[model samples]
Target: MKSLTQGAHHIGLTVADLEKSAAFFTELLGWNEVARNEQYPAVFVSDGTVMLTLWAVKQEPSVAFDRKSNIGLHHVAIRVPEDSALDQIHQKLLAHGVEVEFAPEPLNGGPMRHMMCYEPSGIRLEFIWPGE
Candidate 1:
């Protein structure tokens, strides 16, 4: 037997603020708004290779995602082009006032490095740099 499915088409994330989330991708991450659905109140963003659908929460007082207890997405790991890019982006995140869980450091002991942070809408994101 063989695997029948292809890779991910797109990832959907529920956000507290639609506009803020969209801005995070466009302004901060340099992604483009590819499409929008008014009825669903969602924004589709792409960085040329990957697409993510940001959905607005329909209700107020929504609960935040807890990686320890919740059974959903832990974090979205985005790959950077080079090792130094990780530090560059980390500085950008700080200047933009994004909440960083930690600064860029070794992934385990050697090669790859990574950092953790939360976007404006509280979505956990991990940026990684695979060493050459």
Candidate 2:
């Protein structure tokens, strides 16, 4: 039998506002908006490597994110080129008024550095630098 799955093609997120969420990923993460469909109310952004699809929820009740209680996605962890990048992103997130879950710190003790924050749609995002 052959394996049917390949690496992750994209991640789709349901957001309150498509434009805001699209801007958030583009401005902060340096992703590029590749496509948009007003009819489906979906926007696609790419980091030049992976694509993220943001879908606008219509007439649906909004719910707060609770990692402890929710059974679905916990957070999306993105890899950074260097440890210094984490610090840079920390400042950018702050400037954009995004909530930083915690300052960048060592994950367990060796060389992994990471920081956590929430996107505009209440989705948790993590940036990590494995080591130099």
User: For candidate 1, which ten residues in a row score worst on lDDT?
Assistant: 105-114
Predicted candidate 1 versus true structure: per-residue lDDT over 11-69, tens digit per residue: 99999999999999899889999999999999999988789999999988899999999
lDDT of 2 by residue, 1-132 (tens): 988999789999888878888999898889999999889999999988779999998766877668899799999998898989999999999998999999899998949999999899888999999987
Note the clash tally of each candidate. 0, 0
Using all chains and alpha carbons, the TM-scores for the candidates as numbered come to: 0.94, 0.92
Would you give me the overall lDDT of model 2? Answer: 0.90
Q: Model 1 lDDT vs. the true structure?
A: 0.92
The C-alpha stretches of model 2 lying farther than 4 A from their native spots are 1-4
